[model samples]
Target: MFVKLHFEEWIKNEPGVSENTKELIDEAIICYRAQAYRAAYLFSFLSFQNLLKERMLVASCPPGYDEEYWKGIQSELRNDDKWEAKIIECVERERPAQIFNLSVDTKRQYLYWKDRRNDCAHAKSNKIGVSHVESFWLFFESNLSKFGVGGGKEALLEKLKVFLNPAFTPVDSDPTSIIKEIPLTVDSADYLEVIENVYELTTVDIFGPMKTRVWDEMFKLRGEFLDQLVEFIKTNQSLYTQLLKEDPSKVRFFANDPAFIRSLWYEMKMDFRTYKVIIGLLRHNLIPREELNEMISTVSSNNNDTFFFQVEEPDLLVLEESGFFSEFKTLAFVDMKINDFNWARENRNIIWHLIIRNGFDETIVEALNNTMSNSFIPWRLRDSILELFEEFPKLKEEYIDVNSRINGCLPDKLFNSN
Candidate 1:
């Protein structure tokens, strides 16, 4: 039988999927068909969650994410302040001691990146050197090997197959592949039906053991990393909170606290928030760009020159009130749009290639998910996926089928596909 035909049959026995949720599955499939893996991945995951929530089987959170998961996110946010403090002192405010406290490696990368950024910003007539060309090629080469066109995770697995045991194949596809291939023509039923479906899907599911194992490993690592971060923040909260509470005008205090300064500097170099805040300050006219650079040069010179800004506790309060750091608390998702997912002139054709080649599997699913959240996806903006499923039906049925397969049971078809 054709793969699509098997999918349809599987859907016939799927239990618990609401019609509305089914629609989301269908839409994800359609997105897959249209070669919009980014949209497909996002929508599929959404459909899965909404379905479970409808059944009252799971909370309204992403798969593999729980209350602890959310708490961990909060921990990260608090720690984000340390990095913010560093950027404020070193880059935007040009506090010398802040720059000196940074690790040697960080200082090196920063200097290199800053020079390039400055040249571009000033529109300097800088000569493009051979090294520049080589850097560009190196980046392209690394990405090419990572996610080559028509090559998703499965492809990546194939390349790594040689080192595997007899029972392990690099190209082993996850049973979840079934979920990824849902067409874009189903609609979700009301919340009740959706929840029932999700619970049923979660139990007795069969995405090959190898595939499941790999996915499990990935999630395990992700959870562990998050746990480590949260623990670090909890342990260091006393120091960081104090720094954050201090006045930006009284930057000298940060220099006096040697241990705090060391930890704060390390956090700044690693956290994205510090850089983001610095960028935001420049973008929003909070600080003069030249003045910021001068601060960096000063910090570079002495690494502990804290007399630059006598920042006060009120200054820290002002920043917090401005939404400078606590922006990632809410999830921002929307229905997928072709225009939103496309990049450059060849996107349409690229979509065609991705779609016409047997629908999306795990690799394609990840690619689509990555694309949905690509840096180009915009800030404070989330891509919509729920609506996409409501726009499709056949795809939804396929999603239910996959879930049913995983559960080792028949899938339910709420709507007549005939």
Candidate 2:
């Protein structure tokens, strides 16, 4: 039996493929499994040509595609005898900056595959076999990315600015599809530019949906297109550090991903971003579970800087509004050592930071739940913690007694009786 072909990023599933093209791919897959190598090669070769024609049909650009040339190509594609030649014409006529650009050898391979397909179609004795079918699949899979527009990352981002902006973007444009195009457009060198532009758009008034929903696409990037991001991080390591520090929610997609974290674990410097990433992995109950405690301890020593942001009050407000400091406090409270809530007793300043910023969150409530002792409760949070008794049902204050006189929620009595 033929092993299932893996293209990693779903090259076979490119959008806008014609129904005939889709069926052709399916037929090719079936024939390959049946050991009918010639039949598979012919079907796949036809589908590849048809898929290219379809991508050209729908493919438009910023400065725009040539309607006259493309419409002629489209008209020719409707004819049985002329379409294959027209598809090749489109590939050749397209400039180095628009449509798919091919190298001298790659361009030669296109014709080479075409001739091989002719041998199968005309029943010429070229001896088509399993290797031929597999080689065609491999070639098609590797070159799938070259099918997009050609001006490189600059053109890609220019198009993206309009695509992401609700005002400039077409009403029919799908953000998800545009996201998939990011990898298709640029290589690893331009990945950070892509992220920074996307981040800028999130601040646009009409782009609110992009802000919340971008994490979904970012999740996709981290999964299928993670190599682009991994390379981006390798080159711009400090930017990620700053972004993770300035607004963890901004880089939450990367910070929260265990695979992304574990992949870059040793390569990364021990900074606050490292602290945040480790906390994110811990909070989500992700892998390398036993190593996380030691990981936290290692970075925590370097994380003792007084201010989370290295800026003045006014500039700090911007980062604060973006929910940056909250991640720090959240990380600050994550005690991997037996849920030591008493650590808060020593770090009283973080309690003030918590109250002034976002108030008590789940981590606070969770730590309080671990022990019946109110020793972790401080003077400032006394009234507020009591008020939150019923906020989260599962973590309701039923676990802690606020009114008890024995070791009560009073200011002076908030400490351990022992």
TM-score winner among the candidates?
2
Q: How well is each residue in 1-418 modelled by candidate 2, as lDDT tens digits?
A: 5555663235445433457777788888888888999999998898888877665554454244556755665678788899888777766664524356567777778778888998999999889999998888888877755555445567666766776667876555556755656555555455677777765665444235554445345546643456455445445555455445444443445545655666544445555345444334444344364654445344444343332323335434543543434444555556432234343333333344444445445455454444334455343334334434335433233334433323433233322322
**Candidate 1, 1-418: lDDT as tens digits:** 2256333333333443468766876775576556664455445444543432332221112223455753443343346344323322332222222211234553454345345434544556874343443343243222211211111233223322321222544545442322221111112222223223322332343233443343233222222232332333235444233323321222232333444433443343322123332333323434433344443322222222122123334433443444321221110111222324322121232232222222423333333344443445421111122222355554445544554444432211122212
Best by lDDT: 2
Please estimate how well model 2 matches the true structure, expressed as its whole-model Cα lDDT: 0.56
Worst 10 residues of 2 by lDDT: 409-418
The window of 10 residues in a row where model 1 has the poorest summed lDDT is 325-334
Give Cα distance to truth, residue 131, candidate 2, Å: 4.5
C-alpha TM-score for every candidate: 0.15, 0.55
Total residue pair clashes for candidate 2: 0
Q: After superposition, how far is residue 275 of candidate 2 from its true place, in Å?
A: 11
